[model samples]
Target: MADGCRRRIVLPREPHAELAAVPLVDLLGERLGFSRDTLAEIKLALVEACLNALEYGQGEVEVEVVAHADAPARLEITVTDHGAGFDVSIVPQPDLTAKLHASRKRGWGIELMRHLMDEVEVHSTPGLTRVRLVRKRKEA
Candidate 1:
């Protein structure tokens, strides 16, 4: 690959689900030069993404991380699953300013991923679901 900062990892769908997502955050955070706190946030974002994949998707999960080798490094992480597709637009946006909040044990992943990353994209077609997350490298 010309843009040499790309890595792809395929994780088997297993009982210990966090196994798949943890290493990804470690690798991504390392590659992006993230600090401890920032790395934790990235891990949380991956957790959200992975949980959704494990819960709804079947079979192995695919994760991709793309970054730059040059100045002002930036990275994009994509997690994909072969599962039932859902409409991303249908997910309600959480209002942080509101006093009352909707509290349910479901549908928080998308929102969390969106809040943590600079950009979040969801794509689904029949049997595949892909979430693309972009994060910028902070100046050292």
Candidate 2:
């Protein structure tokens, strides 16, 4: 609806559950004036976060989106889950140069999220994990 408004969605933990990101991204793109390319990036990142929650979380996954009311508006999205969390520092960097067959497919989500979003924050504990993504609205 209005700028600075927030919306939240809670999803079950299941295969392909990340599909919920589609409508959320569409709404954000329309309301916040996100470019096609930016929307694509946001969608991908949101899916990754959701997938992680579906795969590893112990309870329902929560996605929250906030549209800021600032001079240069911004959007903040967060994906949270109650699960057995891991230390983010331990995740090794992905070898982008490696061939698809040679590289492991397990650890690229965090890296991709960081590359796509202007800011990424991850907080984890024994029972909770939260991934936050932020991007600034493009000025016309």
Return the TM-score for each candidate structure.
Answer: 0.79, 0.88
Would you list the clashing residue pairs of candidate 1?
none
lDDT of each: 0.74, 0.82
Candidate 1 regions exceeding 4 Å error are 1-4, 94-103
TM-score for candidate 2: 0.88
How do the residues 44-80 of candidate 1 rate in per-residue lDDT, one tens digit apiece?
A: 8877877787777877788777766455666677888
Write model 2 residue lDDT over 1-140, tens digit each, in one string.
Answer: 56337778898545667987567777766677788888888888888888888888887889998877565777788999999998999988888566366745577888999998889999999899999998887798
Per-model root-mean-square deviation over C-alphas: 3.1, 2.3
CA-RMSD of model 2 = 2.3
Q: What is the lDDT of candidate 1?
A: 0.74
Q: Model 2 clash pairs?
A: none
Model 2 alpha-carbon drift over 4 Å, by segment? 1-4, 97-103
Best by lDDT: 2
